[model samples]
Target: MSPELYITAGAALAAVVVVILLFKAVWRVAEPNEALIISGLGARRRGGDVDSLGFKIITGKGAAVMPGFQAARRLRLDTRAANLQVSCVTQQGIPVHIRGVVIYKVGDDFASIANAARRFLDQQDFMTSAIHELFTGHLRSIIGNLTIEDLILNRERLTSETRASAADEMSKLGLVVDSLQIQEIDDETGYIVNLGKPHAARVAATARIAQAQRDQEATEAEQVAAANMAAARRDARIKEAAYQAEIDRAQATSRQAGPLSEATARQEVVVQETRAAELEAQLAEQRLQSQVRKPADAKAYETRTLSQAERDARIAQAEGEAQATRTRGLADADAARALGLAQAEASQAKGLAQAQAISARAQALKDNQEAVIAQQLAERWPEIVEAGAKAFGGVDHMVVLNGAQGVEEMLAKALTLGGAGLGLARVLLNGNTPNDSNSENGLKATESRE
Candidate 1:
């Protein structure tokens, strides 16, 4: 082991290390985020046909090739985001500024990876900008079929239209869109605001109506609660008053019990005393009736008997006087009848005598010269005086207040009355004529002769 031998060994070891490092350095790796594109000489491909692409694309693995003979390129397979700002007219001819984001990824298939490798392998940093310009024209066509409200509210329709417009164009670029978002919408003519105006106002009015209804219900509930509270208070007061009245009645009954019992006992005692006094008084009255009233009645009956006997004696005396008066009256009547019979006999004789004289005069007047006789009444003066005296003789008293001369004068006048009658007869006889002097008397005379 000399120093020259150690130096040669060290050179060989360094050369082997350099060759391994060079081999490792020339080998290209395809990461999970990218695809590796290899070209220029002896690149192993899967297909035998030469008309197929000559280059090879590999993803998610590593490969070894000579560094000078092979060239390798990388294309990103991971998701990429692009900010899209497009100013274009829609198919409906409305101009709009659409700001959006597109999320895309390179295709994993061999053909799609090969196409992406050729186009964007050297400019991977500028992938987003390229996808933005490509999507601008496609977005215009998509928006043409949509309205402002459909873009804002109907996201599903917006996405469907975007896919229909941009799907084919994006396929050519070897990228698939995971999502497209219209981040901001600018409506130059207030189309979006006016579109939402009716619904916004309706929502605002409905909110106010619901709030007012709730407030009114709350107020009514408050009033009902207050009324219930007042009713409860009134019931409580009524119950308290009823209980107080019951307590007062009970106290009054308790206070009166002793006095009421005493009064009842006193009344019963007074009734018993009154009954005893009535019995005693009845016994006394019965004794007095038998002793005093019976004897007094006997004495009164004896006095009445004596007075009745004395009255009977007086009645007999008065009856005897009445019998004597009746006997005297019968005797006076018998005497008076006898006198009336004598007067009747005298008057009959006088009337017979006067009738005889009148018949004789009438015969004389017819048979003789029918002359009337003149008479002297001096002889008949005594008769005329007797007749005049008899007229006043039946009077019991001659009451002459002119004294003794009046009585004598009355007797003389009675006697002289017959003389006065004689004077009138004398004058009557002076005018008398015989009945035969008349001419009609001749007819009476001739009838008398027959």
Candidate 2:
């Protein structure tokens, strides 16, 4: 090689080594889990806005940081867990020991990174101690607000409340909590143990209840399956029996088909014969009624009619005789009554004037005989009419073949009896006892009525 070429090569190599050294001095790269906070002379943003981050934040990229002018700090963004043990008072005022862990990381945002770089960039190794101290205070504060039961039972609630309470402070510290876990809570007064005892008992009881419900469901399922199986078997047997009975019935019916058919035919024939017999009997009955019974009935009706007519005639005769007899007896009774009245009047007049009383009465009766009779007839009019009506009182029904004429004749006969009574009264008023004449007259009236 030539000397000049060697000198040129040395200069180029020296230039490359210088560039590499400068790059080594100025270049800064942030890992995926880290943020690079470059601060110093040129770290300010464009236009030099006072509100802009004084330090440049780079994440997952390379940045040129001038040595001794711009200082680059790597803020680890990877999660860090800080174990914390603190003694705090719960909401119930029971003093408890709480051991907890806080998983935290540096914020990704420029402001958060700037804040974290400002606070913890110098000593990243002390982050755990800082987080531990920070979480101890936070745990104490949060646990003071929370009951032992809340702490024991509701971890989510406790974590949320803790995050909320520490959010602003952690923002200032440029840290974000990924998880806040309460590892253990110890109660020196046995409050936690006692509290867990009841919960444990309830959990055990609930488990037992669930188990019993499952057992009961299983038992019920078994019983239902058994009953269903039994029912299925019974139904199968019943169906078999029914099928057997149907088969037997079908065979029996097949065997008896001929006989039954014959019997049916015979039954139809018998029915027809019976109907014919009934028709024949009806014909005979009609023939008998027309030929013999009808004529006999007609003859019997004629005989009965003749006998009834004769009986009616006899009854009429007897009734007329009885009416005449009654009318005559009534006339005689009226005459007797008139005699008694006359005697009584005579006796009364005798008391007033004994002499000539009979003569005076006889004279008065002779002079006003018609007036006396009129008065007596008027007074006895109702009685006379009633006596006349008695003639037909015993007759339930009188079928008058002569129609209205016969009715008129019976009325005339009754009126004749009434006239006879009047005649007898007139005879009595005339001071003549017309016994034989009235009797003969009554007999003549009865004969005429008959």
TM-score of decoy 2: 0.45
Q: What are the per-residue Cα lDDT tens digits for candidate 2 across 194-297?
A: 87788799999999999999999999999999999999999999999999999999999999999999999999999998797667557655664565446545
lDDT of 2 at 151: 87
lDDT tens string, model 1, 120-155? 778877778888887887777777877666677876
Identify the leading candidate in terms of lDDT: 2
Task: Provide the overall lDDT of each model, using Cα atoms, as 2-decimal numbers.
Answer: 0.69, 0.76
lDDT of 2 at 436: 35
Tell me the RMSD of model 1 versus the true structure.
Answer: 33.9
- Cand. 1 TM to true fold: 0.49
The per-residue C-alpha lDDT of model 2 at residue 274 equals 78
